[model samples]
Target: MRIGLLTDGGYPYATGESRLWCDRLVRGLPQHEFDLFALSRSADQEQRGWVRLPDRIGRVRTAPLWAPHEEDTRHPGRTRRPQGRIATGLGRAYGRRDRRRFTAHVTALVESVCAGPEAGPGPGEPDRAADLFTAGLYGLAELAQERGGLHTALRSEATVRIVESACRAPGTGRTVHSATVPDYLAFAAGLERALRPLSLDWYDDDALGAVDLCHAASGGAAALPGLLAKRFFGVPLLVTEHGVPLRAHYLAVPETPLSAPVRALLANFHGLLASEVYRQAALVTPGNTHVRRWQERFGADRDKLRTVYPGMEAERFAAVGEGEDGGGPGTLVWIGRIEPAKDLIALLHAFAEVRRDEPGARLRIFGAPVQGGEGETYLARCRALVAQLFPEEGTDAQAAGDHPVTFEEIGGAEVPDLAQAYAAGGVVVLSSVVEGFPISLVEAMFCGRATVSTDVGAVVEVVGGTGLVVPPRNPRALADACLALLRDPERRARLGAAARARALELFTVEQNLAAFRGIYLDLVGQAPARWTAPPDARHPAGRPRPFATPPEAHVLGDLIREPAVPGAARVPSWAVGAEGVCAGARGAGDGDA
Candidate 1:
């Protein structure tokens, strides 16, 4: 089957949240063809370039999500229109009718977003605000397709005025009611960027329309193209959210410098968009139950949700897991990106306590800060805290002589690689106060190492009963859990064995690939076959059908005839009855079967 893999700020890129998993998925399932529709987040990311793509990738189409520039919209084989110039033909400048439509749709959209909870529909009743949001969103998309792009209109003074009127509308929330001109302008610009997919040329028959299934790697703007594909061409959409976009937005909005009114408006827009995506999707796959619950809370159908765990390479850790030696018995290892959310401070405190009890015990932190000044600053703080905690031991925290805590990256001579880093310790620790999935914990499990992790996100879910869990931000509990495993080798060995068994059973590249392969077939099988034809043509064009008939249909067609030999056994009565049905199905078209 041909799959349209839609991603935002990820995939094919050298660096992205979804890059590794997406690359794994594409490479693992070489039987299917994938066309990547990526939205680049910045020029820097685009310049960093893409990861080595596999042969199964048919095409890579990218567009920028950054500010408007001369080179932003340039795609190979497509004419490049100047940043503010409206093109002729299908992309012609909006007429008076188009302007009116844009105003009506934008007004409805902003009003719905501004409405308070008390004004929304309740219980099993249809959500009036949600309905308005959906209608206005698709209405604008339709307008963009008909009258070039919404770029100019979305940033026009009329659009800002519409937003202002919506904020002042009756029953609107207090936060939005205080929106000023600057806030309105900010929201308008953001909305335009979010809705830019509607103006993309990828929706035509030569692109998204030809794909058998549109598989969105995540929700929010990433899924916008898939939503449009389903809307315009009857293509089925499958949405996978490793991290729920609405949940991320809620967490990130506070960190931004935007005013309260802009924050609230953007939050509402994302919430409404997420709900619509869930509502229209043929299936929604969340990476874990943590994310599944978020999707459920946001209006995803319970029956449509599936929990697909992120897959990891088990072979890399196979040696460590199977080896007789389980590294230093007194060593505790911490792995993952260094950030405030990881709660390294709590881990350091717990380790300090651990040192008071076990003098020879050592802690090896294996990772660098994430790509930002904040991460660098946090790493510095962690180092300063380590020095203060172990003043008598040594001044340099990087050295492992007397100081118990040593911060190291993966590529050092002693560690060399990720597997070796896990192999260098007896116990792996995760101290994140906020997490979506405990990837580091899973990696530890893959290495057959006993883990002591703070309970957050999917830690308990991923670890099952194999590892010890403690409440986050509790130094005493974290220390106790670590001491329990450190003091008893047999228990640690048992837990490590069990953890490896679980990881092997549930979290591997092979299992992930198999699950998605089946899911793709199942979704396509249930959806009605879509056939495209030219407007002036008398007959529809021939194309490969996906899951059009049962596997038995093909075999049964040849078996329908009478026995050639007189003594040969005749076909069953049931087989004879299916001959006409199978023959008729064979004439329809050849499917992926």
Candidate 2:
């Protein structure tokens, strides 16, 4: 099968979210061919280049999602026009009629976004606003497909005017009505970028249209191309979300400098986009139940939702797990990117309490701060808190000294790697206030270390009775859980063993690959065959078929040959029934037959 793997700022890239799992999936499944359609978020990301691809990956097509410069107008894959016929500016891209159509569509879209959920009438009447948004969205996509692209139209002054009008329109939200000219302009630019996938050349028959299935690695912008492919070529879309994009957008809105109105508008757009993606997708695979609930609340059909846990390479931690001795029984380890969401403040406070109870207990924090200044700022704050909490212990912020609390990274002298880091602690702790999938917790599980994590995101689901779970933001509960694990070596060892068993059963790359392999076959089996004979061919074109030809059918020799056995009775091919042949193909022995 030919799979079009759609991704944004990830997969095929050397660094990004969802890269490892995607790489693992592709490598594990060598039977299916893959065509990667990646949307790079920044110039730096693209410059870093892609990871080493497998032999099965047939083609790689990438486009920049970042703001394009003047030179980018004539980027490769853009449809060529006659020299004199080319558009020179935003205004010249459309005629008077096209401009009117664009105005109507953009107005409808913005108006729908501006009007809050309350705009929808009671049950019987349906949500007119939602219908308008969907119509406007697809209408713009169709226009972009017919015209060269919507880049010019979406970024034009007319679009700003449409947004402004929608903001000021009667019955719109109060926040939306407060939108200034600058806000309108900002939103117009953002909208243009968000909808940029509509103008991509990937929809052509030779690109996404040629693939058997469109698998979106994550939702939002990544899945936009898959939506277009499904709309254009009847391709089935499979959307997988490790972290819900809408939830991320909501969390990030306050962090941006944009006005409330602009933020609100963008949020609405993302919410609508997520709904559409969910509605259109043949299947929506959320990484955990936490993500699944978000999808369900956003309009994904429960029947279509499947929870597929992210696959990890358990082999790396195998040595650590199988070792006789676990790490120091009194030590608690915290691993993950140092960010505010991880709530290191709470963890530090909780550790202070732990110190009061058990003076010999040590806390090792092993991770580097994430990309922004925020992480550095949070790390500084945490360090300050640590000093204040353990003033009498003589702490060293960079290394483990006589102090009970130590801040360190994974690659330093003591902790050489991830496995070793987990091996250095008896109890792995996750104090994140917000999380999608607790990857660090899973890693600790693979390392055969008991965990005490805050009950957030998929923590409880991932832990699954193997480890202790505490309420988020509760220093007392967190401290108690850690103490419970630290005080009882028997319980810790038992939980560690159970965690390793669960991790081995549910979270390995082998199980993940098998799940997807089966899903791909099932989806393809249900879908009608897309193959058609050419007009000049011997067979009639567009003849309906029951199912697409399986890849195994192309092999020259018999797929299943019965092994010969001494004194075994050979059944004549004509005498054998269809069920007998099927049973034989399923490895039924000659004696059983």
Candidate achieving the largest lDDT: 1
Per-model RMSD to reference? 5.6, 7.7
For model 2, what is the error of residue 7's alpha carbon versus the real structure, in angstroms, after optimal superposition? 0.2
Provide TM-scores for the models.
0.89, 0.88
TM-score, candidate 1, is 0.89
Candidate 2 differs from the real structure by a C-alpha RMSD in angstroms, to one decimal, of 7.7
User: Each candidate: what lDDT?
Assistant: 0.82, 0.81
Q: Can you tell me which runs of candidate 2 are displaced by over 4 Å? A: 70-90, 322-326, 395-400, 531-534, 537-593
The candidate maximizing TM-score is 1
Q: How would you encode candidate 2's per-residue C-alpha lDDT over 1-593 as one tens digit per residue?
A: 67899999898888878999889888888877789998887766766878898887887887777765333334564543321121223357578876777787888888888986658668688777788888888888877777767878888888888888889989988899999999999999899889888877788767887777899999999999899888887789999999998999999899899999999999988988898899999999999999999999878999998888889999999889845443478989999999999999999999999999999899888898998898899999998898788877664533546568777777877678989999987899999999989899999999888899999999999999999998999999999999998899899899999999999999998888988988887776577656432333323453222224342222111222234876566533323455333432211101111
Positional deviation of residue 113's Cα in model 2 after best superposition, in angstroms: 1.4
**Model 2, position 60: C-alpha lDDT score:** 87
